[model samples]
Target: MELPGGLGGNDAPDGESLPELLRSWRNRAYPREVSETAAPRRRRSGLTQRELARLAGVSERWYGNLERGEPAEYSEGFLDRLSSALGLGEAERSALYLRAIGRPPTSAVAPGSAAAAGMDLTLQQFLDNQAPNPAFVTDLAWNVIGWNDPLREWFPWAAQQGNQMLWALLAPQARKQLVDWEGSWARPYLGQIRYARAQHPDDEALASLEREILARSAEARKMWNLREVHEHADGDLRRLRLPCHRGREVSVRIVALRLMRSDRLRVNVLMESGRAVGA
Candidate 1:
């Protein structure tokens, strides 16, 4: 008997059934070689549904429902995981998302303008000019792509670490440098990451970084699962103990500027608040 939405039947729609399309793509993409002497089995040599489900980090039943074309809301996060598991390229990924959601994947990132071109030179000058105030730039994933000399001098760890999220959430030195690490820095940073994840569900790099943090740090994992979100505001206060000044604690005004030309790049500057010492 034919199943719903043309399962195991020729009476399927003119367009390829989503299940069949996924199966065919999976079979072709992950072909397994059999011994030459032995006759190949009737079934295609590819990952089993269970294996695919495992790779996608979904329950086997949910994956089965998806293949069966069951009527259910497929979230972007689920689609992203499935896409990553199947190793879908941009085109295939977009198609899968469209088919599943009846719309294309949305990116929070905006198109970069001419001024955003030559990112290295532009970012270098941007940082260099913010002298005295520690300044740095990060990609959407919070990777420290560029920084100024003051930033390097103020926070040596920032120069050493590639990812700001990882540095704040996982670095041992961060706990020492930031006062109230969990309350002030780690939790808020994790919340920002959660917000970013929601904003850019299709960003595989962000997903991978989150996974790495979850795997490596128990604190980050706990904070991540909380599902909190935060948007950093300009002129916020951040307290840090600068090692260069012999453990002198300073409060700085945070200035976060999003580059209009590029949605992915942002400049973070910390200006020292001219307050009396220990006042």
Candidate 2:
């Protein structure tokens, strides 16, 4: 189905088109201090666009157009070809597709004031009550809105300076602190962000966050290319591996409850299960 902004019968007049809207969004996608790369490297690691085209089994010009964001027809097959050439995983492939379609990256989210206002106090109390279990609330962009003390104690990386979910994944401490850090937690959380991107294409904050993180972290860059989306809901569990505790693994269940008062926030409660206790 076509989204709210698509090149369908409801699009703006010929003079004002999707490209114009997309360019505007792209401009806003970058943070004030950051800028889009002037020239995206087509041939790096001794692999040229032509070589990549041959690998993907597509024409070089076509591949170039896709990267340049020029008007061109995109197919699932073409996307697969590009994904292979770029060595993109599920998250990275998804990110490429979103950018191609003029949508922001999954990791994109608002910071500071752009984040939705204060959450309900009752909700905060509810999150705090989840003790022993590691529960933290995040905005659309995955910022740490609320987290209990146990989480901080177990995963010191969780209580780092930035405390942003994405930052925790990129921070050096996280690798030493959490086990299976990439596959179990990071991937699924990225999937959630991708889902949000699909739902809110025009969300500047979300898109901006995605771009910034992609530029900063290689893990994030690789993950962004995969393009996976997972919904925030109940009964989701992730096992975290930590070093300080002999690389002990903790299993935590993620339960998400949406608030009607603020369509912008999702109150997530993470609870510990049998194996996760004392970790």
Candidate 3:
């Protein structure tokens, strides 16, 4: 059967037109049965172009032009809004961005007045409830925004160094405090920074942070040149040698959780092992 918008084939042809791809997606999303009546019956399962336009807060004509492959340039903001309206997941969002724009959407959300607002009260309370376990929250840039009392008590320098990436890479105390500074903390942290830099190549704040780290620390420059990337995994073990606790080493399990409503803010909790020395 011929699908609406001329997208009836079992699979999209190789090098299929962008308009065809959009139409195919729309037809699949909003499948309808055409009856042998004077007027073709329209079934409503998925969003119509008009509904999508309304949801995205754009003119129906503009959205229709896009589906029809009309020559039109769309802003990133518009594409992002459209993606949200379509209820696209991360992979779908990335595909939409790649098709609409030449590049994939950045993982780093645009910083604005919201950045000043910081984590939501509930998330802050969640971190605070971690209690004896050191817990903190950070934005995509790893800027320390919220922390529990245990973190402040254990790592006094954390209060001074607002950026976790900077402290891990540049601070002298970090090398002394972390058990496997190069292997565990410095290298992995540098890899994380590199990944963030890749996501927001145009962000001045992130760029400046990278520059500052490279300029201040020779080690960071060397690691930056390596161009390694790493993702933090939950339940990873990290050992810290606390100066306040007379050089006692403690093993802590890492627990990282992302806040969905906010722009990639993560809560990191360090649960001390039962065998942890210097409590």
Candidate 4:
């Protein structure tokens, strides 16, 4: 099926589906870093989602639905509540706005979408245009070898975080910082990992990364054993609200980029709205 908003295209090899491409995309969309905030962040700051709703002046149901990534009506009121509750900054607020419409704030050029053998400057320009959005270039196994500065500026730990699927999950700080740690994240993350495993069973690097993450994190270990399969690209977008500079929340859209050059790897781009363009 053609993806919504021209997402997945119809150019895969015979018998290869968009879901397969999505799985490849998900592997590329690995988290930059585990949240490194203190445990107090999870304590809700002595406030509940309900309280945040009340403070933001929106209904609890509306707020809850947003967190779940459910399809629902969104209004300015709800955005205000989410902004206040999640501590979203101006840029993040705009990102949330774009996601509410089911589209990323920025556009990405897939690798190999062009005729060149190296990184495409046009593609790089597209990524560059997505200023204030934390986008990165990665391999099929989710190894982030390069990224724009906004990515590191927004999530400093990303640069230092081990570039692997499970390592980011195993980190305690990252675990605490995830907006929807279990449901929106852990489950599908492992699902994609398994999907990749099926494609590259003999890939020693992936095998070793899986072992390390499962060993270090009980949460990751439990999720990995489920043996579930999910294609990461199926137009699924995760609205992640992380604390950025000065504890301000920066909302971002984590999307996948399928490269044309190396089918073995892809770039995961993080984007936000409402910030000055270019980074």
- Cα-based lDDT for every prediction: 0.66, 0.52, 0.63, 0.51
**lDDT score of residue 212 within candidate 3:** 62
The RMSD of every model to the true structure, in order and in angstroms, is: 13.4, 14.0, 18.5, 21.6
Name the weakest run of 10 consecutive residues (lDDT summed) in model 3.
30-39
128, model 3: CA deviation in Å? Answer: 1.4
Among the numbered candidates, top lDDT falls to 1
The better candidate by lDDT, 1 or 3, is: 1
Task: Please tell me which model should have the higher TM-score, number 1 or number 2.
Answer: 1
TM-score of 3: 0.56
Q: On residues 201-279, what C-alpha lDDT tens digit does candidate 4 reach at each position?
A: 9864456556656655787778878888776643455555556545545555566767765666566666453443354
* Candidate 4 stretches greater than 4 Å from native: 1-126, 245-250, 273-279
What are the per-residue Cα lDDT tens digits for candidate 3 across 18-42?
5666666565553222111225545
TM-score of 1: 0.56
lDDT of 2 at 148: 69
What's the count of clashing pairs in each model shown? 0, 20, 0, 8
Candidate 2 lDDT by residue in tens digits, 1-279: 232345222222334433343333333331221111224434223345554444443456766665566865454434533443344445444445554665533332223211334555676676667776666665555545555676566644333212245445555555544457778667776777788888888975566556555655788778868987777647876666654346566666767777777766666655666634234
Off by over 4 Å in 3: 1-117, 275-279
Regions more than 4 Å wrong, model 1: 1-118, 275-279
